[model samples]
Target: MTETTIPKRGVPLWVQIIIWVFIAALLVLVGITLNKRQQGTVQPGDKIPDFTLPLFSGYEYEGKSEVKLSDFQGKVVVLNFWASWCKPCEQEAAELEEAWQFYKPGGQVIFLGADYVDTEPEARAYLKKFGITFANGPDMGTKISQMFRIRGVPETYFIDQTGELYYVKVGPFVSVNEIKSIVDQKLK
Candidate 1:
């Protein structure tokens, strides 16, 4: 009797390569989805994250030039993230200045502008063009923008007296009254 040799069955090399490619694609998709989900704007009832940036064009904080978010604790903070290159930021600039002047005398509300992703000259020009007299500072490496999870320019975050985020505007504010409305409500 002649002994017959049996061939082992296994996946083909081509099929194994295809499977690995599919797995790699799936992993990439999942990673992208998770990364997007992790980055998000702060919502109401969340505590505003603390940050410090050099004053770009504003009154010096105490004697130091840098502005710290924590320094404005216990006051209503209208924190705005803007860039000079953004048109919406330009549009809302006047309104922000108006609101700043309006509440400045009362000394209860603090308008802090985070000049996001901009150079000093252009940022200064933008502020000068709009005559923004409020405290404006450069975001410097976008640290504050990342902390706020800023999706775009001209985003504003409202913090109540207790240092908790109370409202968020993702785009340029409509008008000075709109800002005043939120600030007034928060002040109360």
Candidate 2:
């Protein structure tokens, strides 16, 4: 008597699909990690991948009409992540203005601000009050905040001419005048 090999059929189709789905998800996440920003702690030596996003810099801030990180290539960029609700950010705005005015002309350095999560109306008002004339705008929840790994308001990252993250300010950046030295050294 010849015995035929019978296929085992105890597992349901749904179970197989679920297992496949989980595996697929895991693979996708691994791919994203390898392609996007790496998970390692970012330091001055790490180079940031080029990214483009719409910024709402004031209607008049030089280079504000429409700004992108790529546009500032080959220059020192002071990138400040701020919000309308942060008091420390409000305090730092004036100094940001001073620094922007001083550094913008002569084309030596560039200042850029990204509004972390705020309403458009409030953002517009902040623009007028803060005197932020450099590249300023809102991230609009389009994955920008996640890309930056923002834990709180007022995280500033300085990028050098080579598009490498030079410095990262954890809290509200105070004493804008003090930054002049830092900016001059890196921006020059």
Candidate 3:
């Protein structure tokens, strides 16, 4: 009888490479997520992050598409992040518009609507429905949202004239007075 040797089977080289590549990609993704989480959201007393917003059609300032946070210096800035599909946003839509109208003449307060992740037609329609006349615009690439670390739609930030965040409202303001109170305090 002759002695026989058996061959051992192992994972293919290409298969092992693919597995390693997959694991590496997954690790990279997790690292990015952790980094973002560590950055955290903007908070009261923090200096407002400077950002430029591209206003929607018919909402531009001085016929300019780009509006910078610094442009509204020496004025209180009400930066509201909202979406057309958000119910809580809808609830405060009219109130926000009213507040804008009230403060429009003074020019001491500037209201900027940052429509979050919304389509133009629908966002325009939502604005028309609510009669929003503020400097409403799309948060392009969600850069503003990321900079502010917004949790959801209808989050409003009150920035004082000095470019410091004074307050953060996580949800809809129940009344125009509620919105005004914050603005009044910041304007002081």
Give the winner by TM-score. 3
lDDT of 1 by residue, 95-171 (tens): 99999888988988988888888888988888888898778788888988888888889899999988899999988
- What candidate 1 gets wrong by more than 4 Å, as runs, is 1-39, 57-59
Error of 1 at 181 (Å): 0.7
- CA lDDT of 60 in candidate 1? 49
Q: Candidate 3 — which pairs collide?
A: none
Which runs of model 2 end up more than 4 angstroms from their true locations?
1-41, 60-64
TM-score of 3: 0.81
Could you tell me which residue pairs clash in candidate 2? Answer: 56-137, 57-136
Off by over 4 Å in 3: 1-40
Candidate-wise lDDT, in order: 0.85, 0.75, 0.92
Give the per-residue lDDT digits (tens) of candidate 3, residues 1-188.
Answer: 99988978989999999999999999999999998888767889999878999999898877888799999899999999999999999999999999999999998999999999999999999999988888989999999999999889889999999899999999999999999989999665
- Candidate 2 has its poorest 10 consecutive residues by lDDT at 57-66
Q: In model 3, what lDDT does residue 167 have?
A: 94
Candidate 2 lDDT over residue span 1-188, tens digit each: 99999998788999999999999999999999886655533566678776655667344345446666777788888877888888878877888789888876668688777888788788778878876677777776645657667677787778888888878777765787767867877743
Shift of residue 138 alpha carbon in model 2, Å:
1.2
